[model samples]
Target chain A: MTDRPKTIDEIDTPAVLIDLDRAEKNIARAQAAADAAGVKLRPHIKTHKLPFFAKKQVETGAAGITCQKIGEAEVMADAGLTDIFLPYNILGRQKLERLKALHGRVTLSVTADSATTIEGLAGTFRDAAHPLKVLIECDTGGGRCGVQSKEEALALARQIDAAPGLFFGGLMTFPAPGKAAQAEAWLAATRDLLAANGLACETITSGGTPDMWRKPEGQVVTEYRPGTYIYMDRYQIAKGAATLDDCAATVLATVVSRPTATRAILDAGSKALTSDTLGLPDYAELVGEAGARVIGLSEEHGKVELPAASRLKVGDRVRVLPDHICPVINLYDQVYLISGDRVVDILPVAARGKLT
Target chain B: MTDRPKTIDEIDTPAVLIDLDRAEKNIARAQAAADAAGVKLRPHIKTHKLPFFAKKQVETGAAGITCQKIGEAEVMADAGLTDIFLPYNILGRQKLERLKALHGRVTLSVTADSATTIEGLAGTFRDAAHPLKVLIECDTGGGRCGVQSKEEALALARQIDAAPGLFFGGLMTFPAPGKAAQAEAWLAATRDLLAANGLACETITSGGTPDMWRKPEGQVVTEYRPGTYIYMDRYQIAKGAATLDDCAATVLATVVSRPTATRAILDAGSKALTSDTLGLPDYAELVGEAGARVIGLSEEHGKVELPAASRLKVGDRVRVLPDHICPVINLYDQVYLISGDRVVDILPVAARGKLT
Candidate 1:
């Protein structure tokens, strides 16, 4: 505590550096895209896991903040963030109790892809004065959690509508990247099916950072949730959603060893940069170091493969653009918020490790 | 805090469960192995990251504990750990200052693979009353940080011996798994080379959980620093180090959504279980559910591919054996110490997220 770093250079190695100016531009850019599409922007806090950024997104015209877990939402709610949408099928009695308690403190909404999840939600909120908004999660194209078909989504929507102390808050789907048309069509058909069944679909939400800027021509999506847009990563850049300059967060590491002419070891590794390749060839891209990439990572050391002409040496500091920003942020307790080369503030990742 | 779980069944989802009985057995088994081999067991705390477990290992006859970073060692030192070995090429002035302060508090030894790291350490401890023990890290086929050759190791050893306020403490290498003979040969050759140069190498150390049980016939390694043995994971099982019954840590997750007949989504995902494949085909192997494997992971959900005959359903709890336990333990703040089905205590991961 006595030797807390002030400037970026003074901060310790393997620290997460959030470029404040770049992050502000990214936030404004995302909000502008959502506003232009006439869809509400609900930036997911799972990326930063910091209430400060979540508040910033909300201040930048985000309708609300989306959290992947109820624990994250609880942290946000503690920081006075209202209107949190947890688009996850939360189970278990312990979490439901927490969810119910959190529901009392904020305008909370959750998603369900199965009847069992809805049942648990209804059972917990049965005696509540306000009905819990439950959205039916649709698969669309992402083959993860969600109802397989629109009929299943409708059935879950009906289940939510009929259940005690539950409100059917339309549909939500984490669609596959670059498959927006198929997702829009599937969601629109589901919306029509619900409409024909005499159930009004109030809000249809679809989200993914890769497809955030690609507005649906069908105008079926009422809200958008983009988690990684605030701190664009190398994966986001590879996906063409952002450029390297748009990347707001980077790992600052020191070259501890140049064991080989072609290899330089960094103090940061999987523990600092994370081993999330995200389908990329390496762990991260070295900023300003052409042809130099983090090829391998042990828990505490990153193996950077330098180009033949590269002059990287021991004691040299380098900034790295991680493959994914969300998990990388989750690895740190606090991130150095820097404006250019000077660190303005240190933000604690309050919602980090909120798995449940 | 009011609803703290008393039992494993009552505990919340996405929680790390450390089987106390199995962990005890693991500690005793590793200690006995080291005792039989006539080598000092310096268990690496990077696996468990808990001082309680580190103390358990030391109490069970470990010589000391090894930490990957100074920050981790600082946590262990603050927890009253006396002798600490940090097998990392620590660079930067801030970390060196912390290292010097930590050296003042405990018996600290660190490794350096290059002249730059050695220079930093020497510069920091130039006027200290007690000289700092510095080991030359040798590349024993691990392909990570270390001097490339025995000649280089001798050069660094001489440099450390000549440097003021620094003691040339033997050699250390994090060898590649299944290359024990090669690593031993390399370390022994370096030891001979140092002895020929009038430098008495005191302690030679080499470690990796995968090759922990394999005794070096050359007897060059005087101390063994094997992490991950405290809580054997699936990777250890695959490496033939331990069986499933020997695994002490398991992630307890709930089946939040059974959207498809073959796919069940668990509350635990990469954020809880981690995405470290370790060359394994899947994220994790399901406990007691044969043929079921965690196929994919999102930030908050794990997509488990269930066997056709499996009767897993939503709201049902499932235990998962992570591929790698070290990083998995880093993801949580605390883990439930369980004795059979009962939760004995909640051990805080005190050294977690100590990236610096």
Candidate 2:
């Protein structure tokens, strides 16, 4: 508390502040883990949309950047990042056209699990100068968007290989936590199936921050994509990804109302900290407080219920480590990067509303 | 499905579409209800941040507009809104200075529930050319952010009246659903206390869409501020404020993947349809699908688990009515105003992300 920064007092209420030192350390630690595992680290830029951090990940030995949409890849490409991986099933005519335009700029790759998605990508890029790389997204206990069985994956891979302009990249899956073994089994079984069918398996990318450090070793999965590890949150802490200190981003909010002795209101609410509690009781981890729970959120008011003896008053600023950092970052247009409370830099959330 | 507009196919996936006809009906119904109840309808523009809608409200018998933040008010003023009420306690050196500047441009009043907040406002406007109106935020039964009792409210009102550059505006409260009686009693008791102290209660503002139709029928409350009534949400519909057909805004998303016979994935997720479920099980009301629930949200994917017999497939576009509309609108940069299925106009969410 003694080493106060002048900028801390000037920061407005309901602002986002990132600790650069902690973020850099998190990035380096994830990179080292991927290096030791001998897996290519394709850091997901969906968490931190700033090009400054995207370039930082590449400079720290990341193979490329991973984004969920072509819009995000376009932002990264505009910032001069060459390699981009979109690990989602992109459809619709406008999106495919935009994806084609993005392919003209960078080393682009996408993931798909269905014939409709494969046909869409092939139709858009069939006559392009370069054959587009498409990965088969496999269902590995996540039960989300991926092919169900090894036979289904092999069928998709053969179709992709036979396509005029699409290259069967490999297998990709976002495994549920504690299912890395299942992901490895699924990918290895599919890779074997592809090899038996004389189809080339180029890269196997499996990812999730919960089991990020425990990616199955050997040649089963070649690359790992982890987004939330860059700025861990309460959800990550609960998932045992990192300690609370490993969390780099926090919301700076002021207690605007002390309605009662046990209840205070913060300027930040669902609009700032996001209401995705990740199954936690509190919307966020109230920094430097004991037994303070953000109980509810209206559009603009965060209701924090405290203990009877709590002395939190109006105009007092407190930092909140959001329960889920990705959506919270999506709420703000820009975030202030701080080094020990001294504002270091402010970066625009480039891919913030690029939801399409 | 036969009446589908030609423009429906052109809208990108995960786009917000405002049914202009439905929105107009909702706005007219709320305004007529306020007029019937003999209260001023000062519509809160936090839900639809577009200037076009705010102007529409004012033109349709609204006394003024209510916004939560000074940033939102600044945008409204830029759009030629002359009178604005910010019913949240603003804090910090930067915000108070901004509030003082806003007071110079328009008829501005704010709500306060603490002495510290009052002092901050008093200090900022101590010698200004105009006296700032300060309303005592009273806690009826919501218990979120307001003075706990009539005594505490009167104390704050007296403090505001005694301050050099502050005027006691009246009382304000965001009462809990079906607590209009409680709000009426609280405001009545506070008004009696203020009258005994020879103070004027100019405008008593009570707000909440849950009991908008039953705003306490008395001269005790002069103004009603219901933000969500303009574009009712699923929560409001459940509270009997409006029907499902009364909902104006909906997210249009394409089913990009059907991983299993019972599992479907939409392009909208937490980033498109917010994770603030408003205590609902699903993040949003899945339109046109019986027994379909938005079971899970991962940044770019909304997993909708339906019945085994359901025939949902990829490339099928569906509409999602969010559980809450205000924060959902805040997430987008602009909205497409549609008449039937054709886009009539495109409005910028001008005050989107002005969460200072």
Candidate 3:
């Protein structure tokens, strides 16, 4: 994507604008690393969720896509991509019916940690021609969702094996940095246990942008699912995971209204950048240098605290690196794909705000 | 809307839910207060952009609706709302064109501060059948949008008066606490100026949930537009603007995984509750009774620092009051309308994520 020459007037204050060049480069770099590592790269589409971005990722060589919910998968599936993996527990009749319908339309894979989740999926897909491909989610140390222990993971895998409409597709874990090694160890042990039990956990999928770069080489993971790498956020940049140049997505906001000497407000606020400060230290900062701290954010007003020496004025255009790229993208209806100031194309955030 | 008795087993976690009784009561209360004051109560639909919510507000005696953007107004207009006020300085040809088109469908009123905004509106509606209803937006105290001084507001109002296709509607301000008196003073001066200039400032709309009840009786403002009053947030509750029972919306999240002795995690994170901590005090004490704070929040997990004597277990459901209710509501596709323990209906956030 080319950056269109965005005048201060052209772009909306506090809008998420994507640098097509950086996005393509980021995608290429991630794909190259996954290729070098000899693993299937299933880039998480939760970051962008735009059909155009998904198409770009697929064009650059991706195994499939990964989403957290049915809403996201539905958007991606509608975009013509057939294979998708929702690596989260899908419960409830509404979600299960949607999942079953999706499975009939496309190749769908899901993850489960509890028997209830498996039973829910089993009930929905019991009579379907295609079995629901499921990966037993492991708590490789993130402690969010997954079986806590290797034995527990194996037990769940066995349960999945016994289930009539479920296929034990793989093992998936969203690991934290300190626990990545432990997660890999647990995966290795679980893989060995599955082998000893004469059942194969073919695809070992592990991911999380924080643990993406430090992915264990000799781990049991056959596939890597990393989101946020496509648009490296403030958190990723602050954690030294990606460089400023690697940051693909930014809130192209203009200084809409400046009222005070010390404070300059941007059109973007919690609504634009969102309140997703996961790995990020601040709301958002200057792209290349430390310029401002988000002092406060109302629904539509982002109070930017600028240094005395900073050269920013009302109506000046600035690129804001969102704390978390996913939710920020989710808040906007459309994003401008810029290369060098020129907006080459505007793409809708199709799966944006789709929290079902 | 009634509460639906769906558990973590039934519905996916981290979804936004609306308590119908609370919501309807909130609407009725705001409307009643405004009615007693003899002011047209046009509640801001930005808090819950769902058509169902808007319909309920109208049914409960709200005069019209208020929105921040033309995109939102378009959504409301499409849902059969014939009267809408966009209380933001809408700049740009595309937005202006949409605004003009919407003027054809509904009674549209917009705000403007600079000559540029008024000029844009004038250009857009130059060929329209009726003059564009223009409000001279004044910055009473909350230095977000609007002109700074009453003199500046008068000058802008005069500019609107001279414009080909613009009519001076009234004065509008998004006031803070200390600024209410100042806003009233400004509105009085501006109203006098408009009357002297042979222009009728029919509707003097001033709003802020914190200062909603602090309006000077029978004085300057003719109308009030309060968005958060419909769905009081944690911030409003903390600020004594609302009570917990008055909070109409909350995220129905499950305790998906309990990770530590001191900390318990919820499925709702920044994606659900959002990073809008303006109303929240400390991270660790967010919604926790005294002492416990939200220690950390990842994209999908909210890490809570629990009280030592507390016994929060895995799979327990907790209602989290978002610091900012508007964006949190926008993040979900549907809001479960809860009455008690049963969900009467699921209201789609129809105008959700419309950040155009």
Candidate 4:
């Protein structure tokens, strides 16, 4: 096999490329912020699933890792990292079986918002040697999942404590910016409600890159789990979660065809950067170049509309910051690591495309 | 290590499942259609990207395979496949070198839409021991890529013939239904122009799933390259390209959470099925169910607005035919191959995430 290569042109087009210097800087900055805020940092590993990067976070005083599924948790456990949390509701017989088994290999935890979900998890682990610990997920106001109100959350937490073979660990929410303050208010109310019911709510976790910076001010948040801060995508930049210079990952692509004077095509399209349209608002600043909107995306072509002032020529290489970085990373097998002017290593996205 | 799982419920959620029985039927139907139309069938491998599927197509009488990138073509060639065509403009020094190397391993051909691209390929393959084949790609009005007029296409074809290590193959286009006649006109004019220039215009390949059934009368298309036929998707069903029963690939997702009476969430989202919203007339659609619209999608959660009369419940496994199949396949590491009610094998998406 070939060794690591240098320069953007040296890497193949449509491959994921990460700036190690930028990545390390972003990690250090986030860790410092969490330390100053006096909250435990549990960085989400859904952005960059490489075990090498995960190890870096663990070495940097992170409380634990947040994964999206049991499959991802299994991959991380195989890499010898413990203290894993699946922030999604564990459902179905197969998933429950997998979750029950995961408890034996590591310090595994999960989230739930309904009685049916809690009952399902309890039933799966009822006869097991270990009880399954879980967090009661609150909507706080993302409106995607979780219980809607403090009263609802408190009821769920008490029910979890009452269930056999299950332990109520804490509360978790994927709070949006608009609801961060509301979630903070609800978290306080839920804590008081739990205290009145003689229940202990020690851990209150709030997540989402958009509202990550506000966790310190929330007062009720004991831990923060932000995914996009590690890579800093276009959407996160638009949401003011991170700066353009803080973006660690970029799509290194080549100009394959300039079909017209105004329209040029890149080898990377939805299959490379994805058809993620969430981060188009901050396109001008992220690329360090002017006047191009990703107007359309075919499977293998990204049709970028060039402005009259833009002077890009055919066969020139370009860098694109996708709207969403996680799915973009899932689209490539390997990512080239760059430091200054030299290539350091080529990291395999070990968990790339492990959707199941 | 695990053998083929028996039931969809036995496997994890958000898995890509292929009905092999349906897939074989779909392939045979497409082959019969091409045979009846008296055109050579060279199926495009962009949809599956698996060597196993490509080999199946060849076994079922496909003339060759069509790819969009040299990387994908190289994967196919490594599997002992012989003939291949990359239907995209080959530009830049790095890509040209890879393309020249690929030509050494297989019967390789590429598409060219401009003089610059043709010249680049010519310069790279000039000293090749074997001749390099070229196809002048014409825009039949998809407005994506290709030359706008027959005169421009012929001029480029003549220029390719004049250059070293170049042989004019014929013409290619990705035209829609109403534009097939326009492409046929361009193909006729370009064929005459190439003949007038004393060049043999052997094979005119024009195709897309939408226009596959509407081959124009007396058109110059001697061959067709229709992808998306092996795994017909929701987009194909909507565009009259293929019916829902003809769809071979479906996302096996479990209803992980029922947040509301009106809204239910599935484990599969853009990460599993992808945001490839192509060929579908609208944003999203429900595969086997009616009036189910995918309202929003996060990384791992697909929020669906349930129809008033729908009966979907929590933990129910639903099969969703993705709006587009190519990007969906790129989002998974393996696909469960099922025949009738039994899973035959778990085929690795061998070239999965090979965006480069």
* Best candidate according to DockQ: 1
Q: Write the per-residue lDDT of candidate 4 for residues A277-310, one digit (tens) a residue.
A: 6636422121755766667778888877777667
lDDT of 3 by residue, A104-137 (tens): 8989999887776777788888788978889988
**Which model is ahead, 1 or 3, in terms of TM-score?**
1
Complex DockQ per candidate: 0.80, 0.62, 0.29, 0.59
Candidate 3 chain B, which ten residues in sequence have the lowest lDDT sum?
A: B1-10
TM-score of each candidate?
A: 0.99, 0.97, 0.82, 0.94
Candidate 4, RMSD to the unseen true structure: 2.4
Chain A vs. true chain A, TM-score per candidate? Answer: 0.98, 0.97, 0.94, 0.94
Ranking by DockQ: 1, 2, 4, 3
Tell me the tens digit of each residue's lDDT in model 3 across B1-356.
Answer: 11354633355566666778888888888888888777888889889888888888888888899987677888888899878998877765556667878898999898887776677788888888999889987878776677777678788888888887988888998886547887888789878877887778888998878777764744688888888898888778678889877987777676655544566666677777776666466432334455556656766667777777767766566777777787778777777776676667777778876665
Q: Native contacts retained per candidate?
A: 0.83, 0.84, 0.31, 0.57
Query: Which regions of candidate 2 deviate over 4 angstroms?
Result: A1-6, A215-218, B1-6
Estimate every model's Cα lDDT from 0 to 1: 0.90, 0.88, 0.77, 0.80
Model 3: per-residue Cα lDDT at residue B148: 77
